[model samples]
Target chain A: MSTRGQTHLWVVQRVTAMILAVAVLVHLVTIIGAVRGGLSAAEILGRTRGNGAWFAFYAVFALSAGLHGAIGLRNMAAETIGLRGRGADIAWLAIGLVTAGFGIRAAYGLFA
Target chain B: MAEPASLKVSVWRGGEQGDFARYEVPARANQTVLDVVTHIQRELDPSLAYRFACRVGMCGSCAMTVNGRARWTCRTHVRKVVGADGELELRPLANLPVIRDLAADLAPFFDKWQRAQGRFQPKDAPDGAVPEDFVVVPPASKARREADAGIECIGCAVCYASCDVVAWNPDYLGPAALNRAWTLVNDVRDGAHGDRLDAVAGDAGCHSCHSTQSCTERCPKNLDPSSAIAGLKRRLFWDTLLGRR
Candidate 1:
């Protein structure tokens, strides 16, 4: 890949990190408060189900996590494992797509 | 008078694959590491190979791995680097291939500087016409100040030897080269901003810097290559966004 493409990935990684920061904080605080307030798994699902706002928020969270984690892993693989070049790029993209796929599916389950 | 103290110094011998040859040298007050090496080569073993010049830390030509850290041997005192057991270990700088005992092949280091476009390209005078007016740049200008911040680098590979990124990625342009490129990038009168920016962008470029500040921490000149690399990153990011790069 060109350096420009790599730069774009670098920028995207930072952007996703920012999104994950906010998302993780909100997620932990809200979920911890709910559990401490005596909400069960089914009760949490009841609150999230049919909620469009919850679906969008969780979907965005999933996407950011996927991109952020994959990019970090890609760098680690390159630096540590010496996995580089086109093969590594394709592998990382697959990892990101799979991770985001599962996360968005779970978010859809909650919404539906 | 009490007997003079002697230090057990282990110096690396041979090229590529070699072992540390130990020597007992008389310790003197305010003795530099280079002095110890010199003593070994002169009195102990005439065959020991090493590289040095200036001997005053200005040239950075006498850099070597002293007691596990890359340093200017001419400036590093024996007292500062001796282990608790009063032993010293010297070797060639890390990352670069060793040419002999303490002399590392600096071709790759300098080649990366070229790869990073660490040279000034003057704006061409059209058709054999020389401009009469002088290009007077203010010393206090922002670009000049930024350039000044990184201009003191003496092409020493201390930052390169200390960088984990360079150790991990061979193709990665090490800190010294990238820092040199940063100085050139900020040269307002230089005509190669676009080319230099492109040279320093990408995975093996400034983006590969993990911001560990190892370069900043190990720099003997107190110059901040990490900050310079961050400047390059910022410049590249903005350029990409503005469609300039």
Candidate 2:
């Protein structure tokens, strides 16, 4: 990858990390609130279903996690396993795409 | 006075890949690690190759992986770094391609310096008027002190050799380049602040740093290049937001 593209990835990783941080906290709090109130999975789904804000929040969370985790793993693989260059780049892109697809599918299942 | 005890040294021999050749030399009081290497080359094996210039540590040519750590051989006392049994394992620095026995290729290491725009770029020549006196900088300023702390790098690749980032990403500018950029960023007289910052802003630049702090730990000058790079990142973020870049 070009130096500029590499740098952009670095910046994107950090920005995604920030997004994940907040999303994770909110997700954890929501879970605790639901469990403490003794709400069933059906009741939780009732509140979340057809909610645009919930869909958007979960979508962003999943996308950020996929991007951040895949990039981080890509770097780790390069350093630890000597996986680098175009092959590694393509592999990481595949990993990110698969992760985002599965994550968004799960999030969609929660709403639909 | 009685003669000092001998030090059994195992120095790496050959190029790129090599094995260590053992040599026994008499150790003197107040002897440095460089002294041991020099004695082995001169007395035992003339074929053994190594690099060094100033014996007092001014020139950074004497840096080597002594006892598994990158250090200035001239300044490193054998007693301090050697094993408890008084044996020394000397080899060339890591990450860079080795040229010969105890001499790694420095071309890639130095090229990053230029890539980072480490050199000072003047804005304009002093026309007829003597350039309005020296630019006064207060020592107590936080930015000035932070800059001064990492400014004393003598082009030694000690920090560069010790860095993990350089090992992982070959294109990464390494610590010396980033550190040099940090010094220039703090320099009030340097005209290429914006350009320099832009040069060091991206991935191969300051953002590649994982902050392992190996550079700070290995620095004989005790300069913290990692912190300086972080400062550059913070400054660049602000600059980019304010349209300063």
Candidate 3:
């Protein structure tokens, strides 16, 4: 990867970190409130199903978490085990794609 | 309170594959760690190898590991580091190749400095003639202040020795070099601003800094390389966003 690519990753990491900061807080609070209010998994899905706004929100939340986590793990892998360069980049990309894939699938499942 | 008659010192004996050699030296009032090593080299064992110049702390030539911490031996008094049992352990600085008893090979450290583009390149006129007019920069200007904040580095490499990132990644440019680049990056008259920023943007450059503040903690000059590195990160972040690089 070029230096620009690394810089892009650095920026992406920072921006996604901010997204995760808010997303995680909202996610935790909402989940806690919902579960404590006696909403089961079926009731939660029933409330979220066919809702475009909820689908978009959850999808963005999941995507941001996936990217944020992958970048952080990429850094840890590089620092702790010396996994870096093109191979490391491709590996992390695969991990991020897989995570986003599953996350979007789950979000769609909840919505539909 | 009475002082001990003699102190037991354990000095590294050889290069990469060496062990500590024990020696007893007379304890004195207000003695530095360098003084104890000198006593061993001069009176006890002439073969003991170490490096020191300008017995005062100005030159930064006498840095060594005293009791598991990188420090300027010339500036570290015995009373400050001596164990409760009146013992001192001396070795070469960490994160660099050990050359001998108390000297580390600084070649890699200096090479990374060059790789980080730590040197200044003065801006030149289009006609390639030296400008006769003096470039006046206000002392209190933000740029000059940023440059001044990191300009007191004595090239001690104490931060390099103390950095965990350097230990984890040898290719990562250590704090001193990155801090030097930060100073040059903030120089208004510097011609290589973009080039220097690019030089220090990637994995082995300023991005690798973990922001542990170990450099700031261990610096003998009280300089904050950690903040300088943060400055570089902000510069690169903006440059990347603005497509300036």
Q: Considering just chain B, what TM-score does every model have? A: 0.94, 0.91, 0.96
DockQ of each: 0.76, 0.43, 0.76
- TM-score top scorer: 3
True-structure lDDT of candidate 3:
0.89
Model 1: per-residue Cα lDDT over A22-105, one tens digit each: 999999998888888587879888889999999999999999999889989999999998989988898898999899989999
Per-residue lDDT for B53-141 in model 2, tens only?
98887888889999899999999987787665668899998888888888888899899899888987654532434355677788888
Off by over 4 Å in 3: B125-130
The residue pairs that clash in candidate 2, if any, are A7-B203
Across B1-245, the per-residue lDDT of candidate 3 in tens digits comes to: 35577899999989999999999999999999999999999999999989999988888889998999999999998988898788899989999999888889999999988988898777775354676666888999999999999998888789999999999889889999999999998888878888888888877888878899999999999999999999999999988888877
Instruction: Go through the candidates in order and give each one's C-alpha lDDT.
Output: 0.89, 0.83, 0.89
True-structure Cα RMSD, model 2: 3.4
Model 2's alpha-carbon lDDT is: 0.83
Please say which candidate is ahead in TM-score: 2 or 3.
Answer: 3
